[model samples]
Target: MDVLNPEQFRALGYRAIDMIAQQLADLADGPTRRPVPLDVRHSLEDQPIPETGADPFDLLDRVQNEVLAYPMGNPSPRFFAWVNSTPTPIGILGDLFAAAMSPSAAGGDQAATYVERAALTWVKDMLGFPQEAQGLFVSGGSKANLTCLAVMRHVMSEGKVRADGMASIDAPMIVYTSAHGHSCIEKAISALGIGSKNLRIIPVDSQHRMDVEKLREAIAADRAAGLHPVCVAASAGTTNTGAIDQLDVIADLCEAENMWFHIDGAYGGFGILAEQTEGMYKGMNRADSIAVDPHKWLYIPVECGCAIVRHAEAMRATFSLVPAYLQEDRAEPWFSEYGLQQTRGFRALKVWLSIQHYGLDGYRKMITQDINTAYELRRKLFARSDYEVVTAGPLSVTCFRYVPAGVPEEQLDDLQRQIVAWTNASARAFITTTMIDGKTVVRACHVNFRTTSADLDVLLDTLTEAGQLVLQGAQQA
Candidate 1:
């Protein structure tokens, strides 16, 4: 086997960097999303596996021309459809360095392991978690949620389930979360052998925050019915409306009931950095565990999430399973003993580098900007007679619909769908739609630091034009 000489490697690396920088500079020249043409797709699919190695520079050029030409537009400032952030340029460079190193961060006496541990520590501090808390980076929100729930199950079962499995428990355990909570929670429950039927869907108040009184009543009813209530999953920032549940009240209830309190802060956990939104997460420190995504709000590259647990020993107990061949005589704790993956990638490098590049103060400014943008968009929507605000916000999400007066209620949903299609087709901006309180409404989330007030104006203007066109088409029919 042969490797490129240092001189050749440096040349290729510099070219790749230049190519990416040029693309970033020209991002505004293209649409947020461009579907690959059928011919291009077919050509890509029909390519046969090569028996001989090709020139590395040629392969890189082909990838740049064919693959990078089309993207989902998550990095674009105009992309407000979902809770995706525009990756910071520094973070992108950190990703390249991590890939070059290719360290298996599962655990060992290696520099990568220490780097990951330090990154996780910074995350704990950033989120106001106790210094004694332990955490590990995982793939993303879904896996982060799963890792937290697994520990909750292990501790709640008194460590019996670790060896005997779910069959060891005689009674079914119950989990509680709001109706607007992410579906990933239910999926975690099902995967953990806890029936989805056992997961109680609690109601939310007018602002979409979880109703604490209802939650208490549900817990009482479950206790009366002889079902073991194990945990309560609270949402720091819900996906639909960016609703932050009443964390303080819920934390009190969890303490009184002796139930595990888990906070799903995948998209909103970093909101704590913004002074204006800090109060919303007042009791988050009391949570037994929190699942947060660095990729979403931290402006890091994708496939990075953190799962922090209050009790470090409990996490180790739940996940540690040292095989004979894998045994090491090191005093330092291995990260593999704290999470699900045994062969983890160097995800922490990007996080560590990004945080260092933009200190806490810088992050606070960016997050505050996003929150202010959300409020600004809501104010604009309220000013319009054709738009109806489904949810009001200080958070980084606003849900509304384009409803001209006298439009039949039955036609509103279809009109909203048409407006979204028109926006996507026009390529002026990207926004999504969701059902809020049984009414279809357009949802815009401001997580990209690059997004601006002008983008929001464009979004509103485009939505207005789309709505008018949709109504005209309906009348012509």
Candidate 2:
């Protein structure tokens, strides 16, 4: 009888629709994309989960009052923290549609198979990977990177690495990555029993890009010292500074060295969607395997990271397991054989629907705007005297520090940290902190699709005001 109450469900549905619509319409004015409640810690509870579920309507009411009213607005035009998502209205609508129609992406039915494969194909094409390459969508970059390294290790070791562990190897297989590469690789080493000690940290250039010369020397030295150079993991865009490595040079090195080349293009690889950055990623097509996170740039909801390997055979070799029930005598796109997915989500729908609704041109425009806004922010900071850029402008992220003219580095670091603290505390907008060459500094990334140059300016002004307040506090003390 309760399930038969369509009228009641309709009323709830209408309420939900209205609330979401209102939230989306007025998202920009509420918070500038950064929600920092100074009093949150004081009020937060350290309790376990409740024993039972509360009334659905009552829970909805609490959500509306607490969450809806508070500004966790990721879509706000001023969120410039860590890499963020800015899903379009169409994408949001598509999310609703996906929820309504939950297609299991385990490759059984013809319809789900066709659509998800089509979306995966589109992703591979965007990255300029081989047509024969196959992939599976995972939750995010960490998982994607894990899948990639797992596949690489599997192929390089010819199944020995997974079966018998690194101890079974004749020589130490060295994994090379720039110092700036994400820690996920390190985590992969620890988890995969490859030994994080075997993961070689190559140095970077002044621009923070992976130094190809240093890499070559390190590989040569390792080989001379009786180690096998198994693979090179290059960062397409670093998380801290959006620093892209010299992919062309690194690609050449990989070819010469005959090692597996994996590009962790989690941040910048997909910028091929942008006209300016398109050529910068020219060498990505040569990668044996690559990782990209849709959650960061594609503005898809969280848990959407993709991995593409040039040869479908490699992925098949990496994650394929042969059990009686799951064994396939002949080849089909039985997805369980590729990567570490048994029952993966129908993530393709969100990506496919987002691209279909926005089109390539719209996505490009948003990416271009975000890049330009980052440059614009750099210009604004350069114009001011109180702040100084620690590095050159970013294609997507900018790092700067607040220091009065001629201040010593020690005092500058403390003041800059204080400035950042005050600015985030104010909660008008949110930037972040990073260390550049051992000095603490503020790091801003312009990945949010909704953020405009105007939002960047407002953030700049708010930071400046906050800096002045910090100076006043210092004086009072």
Candidate 3:
């Protein structure tokens, strides 16, 4: 087999970089979301497995033209349907370098392992975690939540879980979370053999924060029924309306009840970097563990999520099973002992590089800008009689619906759904819709730093036009 020479490699790499740079530079000219051409998929599927190696430059060109051209549109500034961030240029470069190095960050006294530790430590400091707190990066928020819940199960079970499975427990271990909490918590519980039935979905207050009184009542009722209340999972920023559960009150309740406290801060955890939103995250440091995603708010490349635990030893105790062949006499910590994966990639490089390039102060500015923009959008929407502000503030998320005066309550839900479908299909801008307090509403999350006040204005204008068209069609019919 023949490999590309150094000159050929450099030439191909330069072309790839140029293509990416051009794409980023002209982002506004492209549609926020577009369907991939059917021929593109057919071209790949219709081809047989190559018996001989193809020209490296030709393969690279195909990837640049076919694969990189069409994406889910998270990189576009106008893409606001989900909690997605536009990747920073420095972060992209870091990812490229990491891919070239191809280092397995699992363990064993290597630079990649050390880099991961340092990046996690930086994250802890950024989130105001205790000095002794330990963390590891995982695939994303789902796996991060799973990792923390696994540790919580071990610690709450008093280490018996490691020796014996869930059957060893006397009472049924139950976990509690608000209705606004991410579905990952329930998934993690079910995957751990805790059963979804053991998970309690507490109610939320008018502001969408977890109802402290209801939570207290539920815990008491559970204990009275002879059930074991093990953990309380709180949300720093819910995906639906960006409501933050009363963290301080939840922490107090957990302290009194001796239940493990975990915060799923996947989408909005990095909001703590902004000064305006810092107070909202009070008592978050009191959490026993936190799951946060750098890909959402930190503007890093995808597939970077972090799990931090107050008790590092507990995490190791929960996941440290090494065969004799993989044993080593190293004094440094082995990352594989802290999480589920035995083989890991260089996930730290992009995170560390992004942080270094854009310092904490820089990130704070971007986060504050996004938060301010969301609030401004809310204020503007509230001024309109047709728009009802369902939830706003506390974070960079706003949920509202366009309600014209004479529209019947029964027809409002369908009208809102039609508006969303029209706006998405038009592709001027993309915003998602969700149910809030039994009413359908449009939801916008300002996670991308590139999104500006002007963009928000354009979004509102486009939405208004779409809403009018839907209403007019409904009236005509």
lDDT of each: 0.89, 0.78, 0.87
Tens digit of per-residue lDDT, candidate 3, span 130-202: 9688899998999999999999999988998788998899899999999888999999999999999999999
**Once superposed on the true structure, which residue ranges of model 2 sit more than 4 Å away at CA?**
1-6, 32-53, 70-73, 326-331
Query: How many clashing pairs per prediction, in order?
Result: 0, 0, 0
Q: Summarize candidate 1's per-residue lDDT along 108-136 as a digit string, tens digits.
A: 88888888888888898889999799889
Q: Against the hidden true structure, what lDDT does model 1 obtain?
A: 0.89
> Per-residue CA lDDT of candidate 2, range 134-184, in tens?
877888898888988888888888778777877788888889998888999
TM-score of each: 0.97, 0.93, 0.96
Ranked by lDDT, top first? 1, 3, 2
lDDT of 3: 0.87
Model 1 TM-score (2 dp): 0.97
Worst 10 residues of 1 by lDDT: 26-35
Worst 10 residues of 2 by lDDT: 38-47
lDDT of 1 at 373: 85
